[model samples]
Target chain A: MPPAALSVHLSIGQAYAWSVFKPPLESALGLSGTQSALPFQLGIVMLGLSAAFGGTLVERNGPRWAMTVALICFSSGFLLSSLGAATEQYWLIVLGYGFVGGIGLGIGYISPVSTLIKWFPDRPGMATGIAIMGFGGGALIASPWSAQMLESFGSDSSGIALAFLVHGLSYAVFMLLGVLLVRVPRSEKPVESAPSAFEGPQVSARNAVRTPQFWCLWVVLCMNVTAGIGILEKAAPMITDFFKGTSTPVSVSAAAGFVALLSAANMAGRIGWSSTSDLIGRKNIYRLYLGVGAVMYGLIALFGDSSKPLFILCALVILSFYGGGFATVPAYLKDLFGTYQVGAIHGRLLTAWSTAGVLGPLIVNWIADRQEEAGKSGSALYGLSFVIMIGLLVVGFVANELVRPVDVRHHIPAPREAADVGARQQPESA
Target chain B: MSEHDSSQSPPDRRPLIALAWVWVGAPLAYGLYELVQKATQLFTG
Candidate 1:
């Protein structure tokens, strides 16, 4: 299951590596940075939308069926992009990669999550962690690989088209392994997974939205992702900006290095911190991600340009919390909603990610633009944004504190004793 | 194979398990290697 899950995630995880195509596309297509950014942005929006809308279908069809659809949509998106590149029709690329491919991203991201949790009921956090870590690391594989392709293929339209062709076909082949390999539990219900003290009733995706707990987690995930992604989107520039007037001014290569290091932290955190959640529990892990994560932001804001290592260390920790936040959420959902309809519920929860995807970059870029207009330079450019991120994290922390077990009213009839416990305990607790 | 035995242990799946891990691990390692080469510039530069 882990390998099969990785086959799916690692392939679709290439979304993060889309930046490698930007400069080449800009040169080839005469695009602005903002224009080049459109497809990736739209892809993220579609990721959230598709996941929210498609979650129920995926649950109904099963992982094999889901993987097949993902393979087709994702691969065809690339093939279409290849044709778009060949014709130099930028809108075709957007439609292919953004609209069509984004559906693949959304479906593929959630495909293995519920199944892994169901299989590894005893360590749901670790199970989901192993799968999701691939999503974080996908860029590491694709970024350099894509760059090498561009280098070898000459960055022309034909070259870009060829690259897209290879990505489409190879990923299609890789994802098929997952389609062939994955299997659901032999038992009708996955063994009653109650790994933590804050276990909630087994709730269907339909009933989950009515409970305050779901919304609280929504806020929690939204704020956590928002804080982390803000730094991530601007990492290279942010590092360079910090030491703009310093003696040890950061070179562009060094800043790129900083970005890579942060990516590593993000990937490692997905596996390391999430697996840790299995022992420490999900809510407690989130307390670390949100509570301490805010402090890391405060540290970056306060200690500006004083020590390069300190700034890098703080940023890396925050990014790890970001990745950990993503990896751990599925288990967190399972803890609150149970295995029933968790995939669907998780899909709904990803709407928060789509929201944060827009929200995080907007806050950072808007504030920076304003500050730049006002002649603010150095860390001053990001001071207000950091403060806002810290505030958002605080808000998320409060929401996490407000999380309680789901009310029994939302629960599906449990297959075992776990059902009786929820039924009897504080029936209208919400 | 008995259901109890299948439930308790699948004794002969080690080679397939290792192969699966290697399949994913090799590419991941290559990616990590490239990333490390890039990341080293942060300190060394």
Candidate 2:
């Protein structure tokens, strides 16, 4: 089959590429693992912010404009990071990559989601997954490419600087492909004979915020993200640390490959697992994500350092589900609420991501740092963290269970003129 | 065509091209610098 939408694919690549920079950045800047991760963490934070604020703008002005802005910001961020590295200014790296580039990530990330959904209204889950799969898969390509670049460049401060520059430029050109190719579907009025799903009464954005389902989903996404990101942000070090007591300590190259492997799993989860949600329904898929995710954490906590394969397998599964959670949520929203303001709701819902972005890494890093200070080795330290993940997942599972069908009152009907749209499918049929 | 019409000239592509450079060229330049330096390091190392 032909490749998926270009914009969706590119955005995913851009987001996933951040991980490639993490290790070398840490080594070159003489930063700790947590410190090295801060840019990504903060970039995630800004992703929610920009997406939320710019969502309406995206809905009004269209994905093309939002994507254009994203290309500019994201590319500039790379250039800025390069400058920072060349000048030995860590703050600039954070500012450029985390803050500025993060905005690009947020905007670019959401740009394709709503647009893709509109194009494939019949298959919202699969469509969203197809787009989001890129975000997940982007890392797989980026990790190897980045590693190769670092290997070639010497892994020094200057080497990192060069990598940042190249990353900035290349991604900018690549992302521009999305900007150039993105086209809004023409607003064709439906014939009178056709029944319209979007033609019904509308729900205002203000009222949609008041519903319990919204808050329930908010909690669900927040907890799910926190669970997954805790593992992702610290994948390389966490894996090595978990295996520290093993007879065969993980080699640096091996650990990096492990990171790449986890990335592949993450990417694959976005497509394979999330696409499965379309068949099983969003709620059931989430049950698997949270319940299985919690179990995965438990397996880790209980089995610490005994079997490397088991540990890696569990972590990979958890990460995959984490990616699936992200990929599937947009479709979930479409299923619950109509697409009238899904983009807006999606933007609002991303606040959960921003919160998790901070909470996930903080919880993992803080616990790990404390454990290391206490001379806790291997599985012992992670036991408490995994327990916490379990609790979080349980909470998420409860939130998912709490999701009843969205109230009819919350539906944001199309504008009065467009109310009789015969082109769109009726919710009754859905 | 009138003298004024001839003098008016075609629309400037400079600003548009300049914008693309800032957006496009800047990132490429940075990436190239990094790639080149890294290539050199690999050779020397």
- Model number 1 iRMSD: 10.4
Residues A1-430 of candidate 1: C-alpha lDDT, one tens digit per residue: 7898998899889999999999999999999999998889888898898889898887776777788888998999999999999999999899999999999999999988877876788788888888899998788999999999889988989999999999999999888878766766523244444442224457878888888999999999999999998899899899999999999899999998999999999999999899999899888999999999999999999996788888999999999999999999999999888866788899999999988988999999999999999999999999999999999999999999999988777776653454333222211211
Winning candidate number (TM-score): 1
> Candidates' DockQ values?
0.39, 0.03
Question: What's the distance in Å from true for residue A412, model 2?
Answer: 3.0
Off by over 4 Å in 2: A1-12, A19-41, A83-93, A150-165, A186-204, A240-252, A372-375, A413-430, B1-45
Instruction: State the lDDT of candidate 2 residue by residue for A1-430, as single tens digits.
Output: 0022444354435555666777777878888987887888788788889888887676665666777788888888878888999998999989998899988887778777766665555566777776776665555456557788888986888998998888887777677656654543322422112332243333444565788888899999999999998888787677778778889566665666666566667767887877788788899999999999998998888885787778888988988898888889988877766555667678888999888977898898899889989998766666778889899999999999999876776664444434223112111110
Task: lDDT for model 1, please.
Answer: 0.86
| Regions of model 1 farther than 4 Å from truth | A188-200, A414-430, B1-9
* DockQ (0 to 1) for model 2: 0.03
When candidate 1 is compared with the true two-chain complex, its DockQ is 0.39
TM-score, B chain alone, candidates in order: 0.74, 0.58
TM-scores for the candidates: 0.93, 0.77
Scanning candidate 1 chain A in windows of ten residues, the lowest lDDT window is A421-430
